[model samples]
Target: MAGSAARELSFLTISFDERLVEVGSNKCRDAFRELFDHFAPRLKSFYLKGGSEEAAAEELVQETFVLIWRKAALYDPQKAAASTWIYTIARNLRIDRLRKEKAMIYKEEEFFATKLTTHETQTDVTYQNQMNTQLAQAIAKLPAPQAQVITLAFFEEATHSDIAKRLALPLGTVKSRLRLAFTRLAEMLEGSKQ
Candidate 1:
């Protein structure tokens, strides 16, 4: 009887282990949803304290979920809770957005400085005008979508994801457009150099 009891306990333990594995597989959505429902408000509070408006905070929350969905396969249950993983995604995305915004501001400043220097030189107005005309002609030759992508990426210093969101495009489409645009621009610039 004692031997049978031991055998029954071992079988029960094995069954529980299988059940745990099934639960692990099935629990991703539930885990993510619970994590989102719980931590979204906390994330909003964090963003608000960091000076984001309510709308921006909400947008960040949505972006965080999107990232979490994309990266859910990377989550390791042994390493962190779902909440920790989600918060880390949120924090990292916020940092990336802030850095991009700062870079955009810096680029604007540099462009302004370059314009000032160009104006002050005034020594080759005709040559500069010719170069400008060439550049305009090259840009005009690009397809409309390519032109638009280049404008947003270079002139506006928009990130690929930002441009994708702004243009209501997929991130893959944005990346492809930008790649094709750069290839075309490089070919044009290289031809002009010859």
Candidate 2:
């Protein structure tokens, strides 16, 4: 069994290397097709065994062949076997993908960091203090029940159900009070703006 397997591998190496040369020199579609058919599954298995997920394995195989097609003219059977050339392409593609993913994560973190810093540095502390004072006055002007729901929902970060349970009120009652409080706050804030 091992001997037969070795024979088959030998045959594949010889033919696939020749096919790659054919593809490079003649732009031969048939040779390219043969190479793709033989190597795609093997490349996918290689990636999967290297800890890539199935979908990622398939993607890497596709990218490797596309690259192999484009770069076939650069392949030199004198330097390496066809399988070696293909696997090297696949490995490079995987490394490129990992680099891109890492770069995206780094960019996202950088963006958020800059955004937070800008907001903090550019804020008008006096304006913020004034708005807080106005908001407090407006809440005090709300009827007791409406203020309670608003405070619980916004300040304490309670859900409507939790606010209702805390206040011994129905969920619907909590929602209505929050809506009314929002309307009053909007009017008061708008009036102050004018």
Which candidate achieves the best TM-score against the true structure? 2
TM-score of each: 0.37, 0.48
User: Candidates' lDDT values, in order?
Assistant: 0.59, 0.70
**How many residue pairs clash (N, CA or C atoms closer than 3 angstroms) in each of the candidate models, in the order given?**
0, 0
CA RMSD per model (angstroms): 25.5, 26.6
TM-score, model 1 to reference: 0.37
Best by lDDT: 2
Model 2 lDDT tens row, 38-125: 8888787777765688998898888887878888887655444566567566655655666877544543332354456453343332
- What is the per-residue lDDT of model 1 for residues 79-139, given as tens digits with 9 covering 90 to 100? 3334434545665666667797754454334235445644343443233223334455667
Off by over 4 Å in 2: 1-4, 100-194
Q: Which whole-number lDDT from 0 to 100 does residue 9 have in model 2?
A: 53
